[model samples]
Target: MTEQPVPAPGMFTLVLHTHLPWLAHHGRWPVGEEWLYQSWAAAYLPLLRVLQTLAAEDRSHLVTLGMTPVVTAQLDDPYCLTGMHHWLANWELRGREAATRRSGADTGYTEPEALRAFGIREQAEARLALEDFEVSWRHGASPLLRGLIDTETIELLGGPLSHPFQPLLNPRLREFALREGLADAHARFAHTPRGIWAPECAYAPGMENGYAAAGVTHFMVDGPSLHGDTSLGRPVSGTDVIAFGRDLRVSYRVWSPKSGYPGHAAYRDFHTYDHVTGLKPARVTGRNVPSQDKAPYDPERADQAIDAHVADFVEVVRRRLVSESERIGRPAHVVAAFDTELFGHWWYEGPVWLERVLRALPEAGVPVGTLSDAIDGGFIGAPVDLPPSSWGSGKDWQVWSGDRVADLVALNTEVVDTALATVDKALAQAAVGSAWSPRDAVADQILRETLLTVSSDWPFMVSKDTAAEYARYRAHLHAHATREIADALAAGRREHAERLADGWNRADGLFGALDARRFPR
Candidate 1:
């Protein structure tokens, strides 16, 4: 058989999104705040530290962090900041208690030796805070993100205030959300974002105009969204917006929902629990085993798997880059995008796998660059309009507003509209530059309420059934804030608006520069 020659030369781009919804003022004990804290510590903080370290070494990460407005708001929020400090302290206490349990000889497990070993390991892990808490979370806005952006180590991309699945939203609402989100990004991050990450990677037929109006030039879509056979960015039907499709072949090599690398037997079991102590204690068993019965993680075995996967992924990327660049006689870009949480939140060894991949890519001579660089270079051409689609189930919006989440979407729409209207009236009556105007105070509070209300986390929490109570509480808190601000404005109680705005700002410390002019002219 005649051998097929190599294809065109191309590049590889990696985009990682970092976001988490408002968890402060909601849940903090046992389940609620713990989830938030762990993610902050495990994935977000560590990821940032790693990136920063890379930057110091003059290593170009070629990564983008999509700080959704809602997430940024929460991160910058004073309430969240204070809450996180307390949460970190509580974690340290937990670690201490775990250490005591390990040493006191009071753990009455049937297998004392095994129980002792587990306790000791757990205690050690708990006490180790990776980086100092203050240094990890630091001031308002993720310290890591703020540092990276300020240093130009990463190109920051912004998203809607609450990451609302815009494609399904009313066009006006979508426009409003995008406008507010981008403006908020500029105010908080102190940089204008050139690109955006459509919440859930969701796009609709005419959403490009919404993006364009908001000043976003590019976004990402699923591989299947491009008819399952392409990897280039293309235009929607009638706009200049560029929609970059994921290279599923390469992406699936790392994550593919059911068939992804996370399902590997050597990986930690994400859903197993200890029958004795009620904590997650099982290891990753065979791939086909029920999650409840997987074996404990074997670091040795997991390391082996990581090495194999990294090698396989490098080859996949290398061949694709070389052949694509050769095939089209122009450098082609193969973008592999994935959720940031998948690295450590869902896949236990994901962080390790990631480190391996990052280190291995350069060694393999496969040049890695950010999506923006690819666009800046000749790898991608003129912008194209994208069709309505998401990287969700069936490459649509089922996961976000599916049968189970549809009701939540309706509720979100009404609440967001109600909040926006209240803010509009307040802005009208307030002095634009006055720090103490009643109307302006109300306007800002209303904006805060709008943000907390639109957090996509609420619907996601309810849909996932992880922490429904916390979700419900947060949604209601925003609703209440919105209603109270509106009532104050209607009654011409500028005093009340001023007072509430102060308190709300203290509580909702996000979007420090939320200007009301972003609304329609």
Candidate 2:
């Protein structure tokens, strides 16, 4: 009799984390609402379109998606919807200007043909994006996401409000944030997520208890957090919650410091911009090449590169799964996690590559499923004690709490303590009441500002030196608001507190349903 062929090794799950700071009414250019609109138009819209198409074709749950409550709130906010629509219209106008204008040395586009081509492409993209927005996203993103979840096109992972680095938050505050964040999701989509892409994938020794208490069944961590053995999801000691490690070998294939698919010579250079169009039009000809020296981006060449990279990635997954399964004598699990924004926002062709990879993986005999599906499919391993870790530099908290951001760490602590104490005191003073009232607004604003102040983005910005000034300014701005509101509440100046809260709410308002009273004294 012929020997039975060994079944192809375990499955592959692609986890894409979608997050951004609350940017509805924040600044407009450089690092504000523009960031939100650009990503919305490029990444979210296109990625969702891909998933929806796959779902229609009966290929659902091809990837796991993580959308933090903060980002969800912004996506659903009416103000943001209107703003994004207007921004798309403006983008089309900018494209028109680029086509009509002449390029100079300062504009980075040396070739008129290249500039005109980029302009036409931009105009077409903007018009199509606007049409999509008006047809599908005019109401809000919640409905679109809800339909995807209902169809099981993706498993949604919710995160804490404002994406705080959980390891450093006070335990009570941590629990509060997690509970509230989950509640926000349920309110929006009518489904509570069981798995979360922890902000920064940061974890501490005792967070398992928090996960258990919050009813989370699983979460993602760095591969090194599991000592490089990512063949299965391990249960945290003494808890039913599972911790899935990202397979860095597969993930870094797409993005890494030294090498990544995005750096291909034919791919659009993320850093090189056409000043005339305010858009990128050059290929990454060679590393460290001057912007002017780069070659024009060719769509046909980039399409070829994308196809080649997708094949390479599928093979990487197959080899990893087969090797790990043989070593362990069972089907192994491989998860490739990446930030959702990296797709269309950072790498212009990422969404296309993702759609192709998802379709190609199963054809290559490697099945694609969500992290939850992996656990249910018997990829769970023996319980283990997880170390304190994050998916940051050195696989630790250095990116958020290193010496480079010591000042931010100190500032966060002060702001959180003050806000929690003041909110508790104010709640106690108020007479017992029903769900929400004016008495709760001060405490609500305090928590909102506090959450904003402790966002992981601040330290990340400081460490990376990317918009460090804006990050610092934002941190201090929220901290200042938190302190002022807390002080007003403490001084029994209810009117003053209301005014301060109102101004801050109008400026940085998100999570309108947040109740500060849920926090412990």
Candidate 3:
């Protein structure tokens, strides 16, 4: 038999950033912890299945997985673990109840039978999710992810605790956060990350120095952040720490946050839900069609669409890699990064599509690997001085510090000042300690609240008009917590500050290695 030559000479790296702001003890129903539980069940669990299957096949370096410390803290917290188990059990109950639910006669343009069918499907899905959670994630996410890292199935990327928008963060606090975040990863997985997802892929002109200081070898930014030439990872600010840009042309071909393959007419409609069963029954019939008039979702039809998309995406990557290699005079590199939650949480069929694409890419002569492989394989380019940018709108910092979230911007500034000053004062009054040693309780708690307040999610949510009210409330809540503790410490009310710290620790505490002295002198 004649041997077929390889189809392309390039590399494909898929990076999935898994993050959700710390939401363990927050609100439950409409948002907050609900988001955490849903994403865990829908996206994280299914995502683990996909990667786990590949791992079973002895696949190594399948993708790059970014796990933020803040999110990690929540996933491993005792409270969150208990809550997740309960949530999963309750989901099974809800599904069981819904399976026999009757649709209201006034159920706007949908048929009653479709709603019942969705309920039946949800019952089965919920049961499987619960079983998976029990068998795998019952302890925490650390063990599952640790196994992946140990087996080389995925390369882990660590980021700043709380996912603060580094460009907007104070340098001292930013440095402290990054160090603490890396330390957190080391504690959980026993591996120090050489790369980070860089919180929204946000970068500043001099931020590479921070990456260098924290021992980060590489991080990701948007394509435009690298001026649209993303064929290679470029060294930034003359530092050994490299910056890889997400290839948007190849990435957007799969999906973006608001659109892409997920918007196909044959796929499950994310926004259209059956209120009676708390299940999505509709397909994305048409862009102009109202939710009430949408057609029922069909798994078989979605699978067909997924197969078509998998083939198209593989072809697109093949062409891009060949053209880029020819243009750059080297075997070109492409990286497609997305939110891990986008898979099963936002797009119901996303996991299926992911598994399909990952398997198909290799068969199509595209070598799928992680970012670490790209760098080690010598995909380095010339140094580029990256401007202050993010993967957000305008490929700049607008989504975080723009006018829409101006109030949050101000709140963060004030909170940081108060927390930093209070910590400095506390340290001056007390005995000096090493960076790793835990300082005063009040100071540490204040820092914790301060870090949570500055998380990039708040401002991003506000700017995007997604859970805006909740974002505002959380920013103010964390800010207020910082001020309350800081004021108590300032007045020499040591007892009051300690008590406040104790009370707040029930909700805000995560990083046990967090020391107040590390923030300043």
Candidate 4:
């Protein structure tokens, strides 16, 4: 195996991106609930629990977590909180069923011939903590998480609401997304963020000005964005916004495009479900599965694989740190960043790997530190203007606003612009008024409608081809609100505006204190 570089004694940066799209007041049950519950149970809770445990042990793992305003709105929304309550109860029911089947309870839901199938599904649900889903989401936006932020256990990063792939978006509207996003973060967390995840680690050459305007000093980019040719901590546009490029060489050691440790032969296959039922039941030893066949999952084999991979990764990071420190005469921090969902939500054993890795890092003499620490400790080098790129294919916007969703870009552009103009007009008018009339409420709804309408999820869903129908429906719903508010004002229907505002408030209540002035004129 090729040797990895080692950083000096005190240089390592770890960024964990925490993001979930707005699923509030959108829908419940079936696929929508699945998206929320699965993530909540598998990734968010386990990750937080792990962090809390570490913190309790007085282990301060310096990490960066990005919770977009859109995700925060959903996490704190009353509707979502209620839906999560029901969803958790149902999830526990699923776990009970799985447990009963595994115990051969003769619950009238099992067959002797399919004992193996029942066993696998039971194991899957149990590992998922399906029974704890309610408690998980309930405790997900944990006081402990807030503690981490307040105590500086981790550096909190911010991002655009709904994570619009900004480089491909219109300039003025992208500016709106960035500014409002930062303001929303400030309102929610009561602290301004020093950095951002840059929405998919996507950056365009001139995007630094927007970051500067929003008071963000640092943002991330894919390593390849720097032509796969330079070190981290480069400056962009002669501004204070520092562009930190991901070290793909080190990152891919843990997560690769095609053949990461997650895809090891002994690991559980993400695809290949059993034919008898929809349960996954196998491991892939190689890229050697038929186009259409169910594979059996092996937990015992997967556990062994996790151990091996964790050991190798820890050593790799250690070696990298040591070698780099030796070369530079200073500790060289190796930043390993990945989607937080990778742990358990997508890669089934991801959470386990994380626990092991976190524990191993300290034992192996490689400390985990946040990006802010790296910047503050003078580990930073000269900054450079990041090229327009993303963590998407070729680090481009193709994954988000690609040919498949070609029309959404222009449609969203017009709607967002019109909505912004409406807000500007309303706020300007309301400012000069003597009293808060009923029209103010109508104007408030218009602002809410505009933000929700401008969510980047619609175009993203269309591009990804997942839940495209629901995406279109949501886009239209918000668009309708924006249009109706315009019509209500144009017709001078004072009573109509009040009625519509009341109805809109009832239907889409959220962050009612938003100020439309955050958007650039």
Candidate 5:
């Protein structure tokens, strides 16, 4: 008898999560609308282009893309579109300024050739980004994303509105947020996502039931959440909802605490900036090197690094797939997850690396697919009980609920409790009286502010110490808005409540179609 052939290696899933706090009409410089526009120009636009190109070539379902409802709202907002256009135009102007200053004596450039090349490259990129924005992104990103989904080029994963740490949210609010978030995605894309990115990949026991009730078939979690056995997607306890654990061995190859491809000496340094033009001009010369001592960026050098890194990552995935499959005595699945913004925004060359990897994986006999496809392809594992966990530090809920952010946790509890109570009372009164409608604007705004206050960004920022003050201020501001509106509504001051709602609506307005009636009474 002929010897039986060994089965092929297991499949790979790349999960890229895209999210940002509601930034429209927020501050512009350093960390607000600027953050949104920068990421849009540098990351979202390029990634979309790559995926669309692949779709044109009949290569579909390249990766699983998660876009949160809050970020989607901002992307589709008219105000943000106009602002992004203006931001792009200004970027081109800055590029021109850099080019003109290249010949100046006080520019502090030891290499004139590199300076000139940087200027020309910056100008070209800015012009191209502007053109792309005008032609494709002028109306909104929803249509572009919808087309990709329609073509099956990606499996979209929707998440909660405002990206709250679900494990910490009140159960009623958690369900309300998840339902509303999915509804919002359907409204925009005409598709209901079966998978959720589960804000921060955070999970708690029993949350699977919530996901099941909300129609989510699968969600992602950290590898440790599965007892370090991330070779297969497992069902949560007895729930039918599946949880795919991120394979950190593969993911950390690209990014981790101690090392990552982004930290290579040839890659553009994210920290150092050219004060004159607000552009990054240096390469990461060394980990310990000061910004002033860093060498100028060389595109050729970065391209070589990208090629090497891409090859390295492909080999890593291939090895892991073969090893895990043999160990499990069956075909195993490897899921590598990442923050979408890390591509063009943080690492600059990340988009190029991604494009190459997507193409190279298939050539190496490693099948790449989305999490949904993995399950449909028969990679399910035994059920396991997941502990309270997140993709944050320590692989626990500490980043959002730790001692450093205890005040934020307390603030969120107080705000959510107050908002829910006020809204419930108003809904009851409306049912009893014929004059009031179920959809009260005051109550709606209150819930909106409450959701904003509970965003996991506040605590993450506080713990990480990056823009902590702004994060705290934003949380408190929304909480204050919720409280003031609730108080006005309680006092029978309809006019005052309307005024307060109108003001906060203009400032913190997102999810324009949200109706407070969706909340559980």
Candidate 6:
């Protein structure tokens, strides 16, 4: 018999999940709205420029971008828009201050005020970001995002309103959030999303029914979530909805929890900051070296590193494609999903590396496209009963539901149970003879706080000890907000309840489309 040729090697899809918890009216210092503005400046803005540039060259379906509804609400909010503008101006102001700060001759900074150049660079970046924000993002992200869609440059993924961990959530609330989130996508993009990033790539058996109910056709999960067999998108629970697993082997090449391209000696040192000037003046000279001893960052060397890494990444993808196809006895699909903030935020040279890798892949004969394209190109495999999983530590739900966060697990369940019951009871009373109505303001606020209380960020932060204090504070704050409103509703204090709800809405006021009456009975 004649030897059979392995057809097309494979394809690759890149998914970037963009999200930040609500921070419009939050604090500004060590953490709060600063998180929002920093990411907006460092990651989202620069990354958009790269994608827009690629689109100008007729690059279509380049990547799948997920912006949770909460992020959408913040981006479009008048309050956040005003705050971001001021934040950009402050950044520029800081850059000027850095220009005046001189380093001691005793320090290794060789030249007097060697930070002057870094300060100048910061000023230029701030000015560029200011212009970008004022002209392009002033109104909202939708218009700018729409430009990408209009040019056929990307696919957008939508998720639940607040990024709650679904497996631990009440099914009714889960469905409600799912449907409302898609509705949000329609409002922003003029198209109802058929796919979601599934809030941390969290999945559980039978969750597909809710996805199918909400009209979601596809979602993402981690590699181990599918038993490490991630060469194709698998259907879930015999439904048309597909679950695509991230290829960790390929993804870790650019970024992983422990090591990646960002750790290169040539890259700007993320941890070494010039305290006075608030700038990173050093490069990654050595992992164990003190911040002051690190060498000054040289842009030229970083550029070389970016090119070499991009070439290496392109080769990795090409080899993975050919080898995986041969092993699977068919064409394969390699999906690499990552946080959008990783580029430019955590990894300074990431956006450049991203553009280079994206451009290089196709030239190297390793195809690249969005998840949607992979599906249309026939990357679907047999249906699966995917176990409960997440993209968190250990590729399991332990990060959100582990011994460390057992208190949070209890708190989340408590708030959800109370808020749902209270809302249901309030609605029933209002339907019969109460002063308030089913779409009452107090009820909406209760649900809002409840949802915020269960955000995956809180527990994950707690588990990882990353700002665990702030995480606990936020969780308790929201839970208390829910309790206050629920107490007022129970006491039949309509006027007091409305006032309480109004006050809460001032800070947490988002999702105007979230109708309390429409919530499941």
Q: Where is model 2 more than 4 Å wrong at Cα? A: 1-7, 102-105, 431-439
Query: Which regions of candidate 3 deviate over 4 angstroms?
Result: 1-5, 102-104, 107-109, 432-438
Point out the higher-scoring one by TM-score: 1 or 3. 3
* Ranked candidates, highest lDDT first: 5, 2, 3, 6, 4, 1
lDDT of 2 by residue, 291-360 (tens): 8889988999999999999999988998999999999999999999999999999999999998898888
TM-score of each: 0.84, 0.96, 0.96, 0.85, 0.97, 0.95
Between candidates 2 and 6, name the one with more favorable TM-score: 2
- Whole-model Cα lDDT per candidate? 0.68, 0.89, 0.88, 0.69, 0.90, 0.87
| Residues 194-290, model 4: lDDT tens digits | 8998877877777898888778888888878866633347668799777777777778887877768877877766665433333344566568655
Of the two candidates 3 and 5, the one with more favorable lDDT, higher being better, is 5
Q: Candidate 1 on 1-521: residue-level lDDT in tens?
A: 86643333566777778777755555566565566666765676556656777778777745777777766766666666777677656655554444344332322223333334544565565455434556555676555576687776677878877677776665655677777778778777668788888787887777777777677887877877776534466756667667777888888888876687877777767776443342333456776677534555566788898899999988899888776666666677888888888877777677777767877787667767766776677565544545567776667666677777676677677766776676666555564677555425566667667657766677777777877777767777887777777777778886886787777766665666555555552
Better of 3 and 6 by lDDT: 3
Q: How far is candidate 1 from the true structure (C-alpha RMSD, Å)?
A: 4.7
Worst 10 residues of 1 by lDDT: 103-112
Q: For model 1, what is the error of residue 199's alpha carbon versus the real structure, in angstroms, after optimal superposition?
A: 0.9
> Which model scores highest in lDDT?
5
Mind giving the per-residue lDDT tens digits that candidate 6 earns over 441-510? 8888998898899998999899999889999999999999999989888888878988989999888988
Backbone collisions counted per model: 21, 0, 0, 26, 0, 0
What are the runs in model 5 whose C-alpha is more than 4 Å off? 1-8, 102-113, 433-438
In candidate 1 the C-alpha lDDT for residue 268 amounts to 66
Q: What is the lDDT of residue 279 in candidate 2?
A: 81
* Cα lDDT of model 3 by residue, 1-521, tens digit: 86754868879999999999988788997988989989988898899889999999998899899999988888888889888889888877777765676663554436667666766888898889888878888778899999999999999999999999998899999999999999999999999999999999998889999889889999999999888999999999888989999999999987876668989999988887666556677899999999888998788888899999999999999999999999999999999889998899988899998898888888878998899998899999999899888999889999998889888889999989888888887887676464344457888899999999999999889898989899889989999899998999889898999999899988887897898777756
lDDT of 4 at 193: 84
Candidate RMSDs in Å, in order, are 4.7, 2.5, 1.9, 4.5, 2.8, 3.5
lDDT of 2 at 329: 94
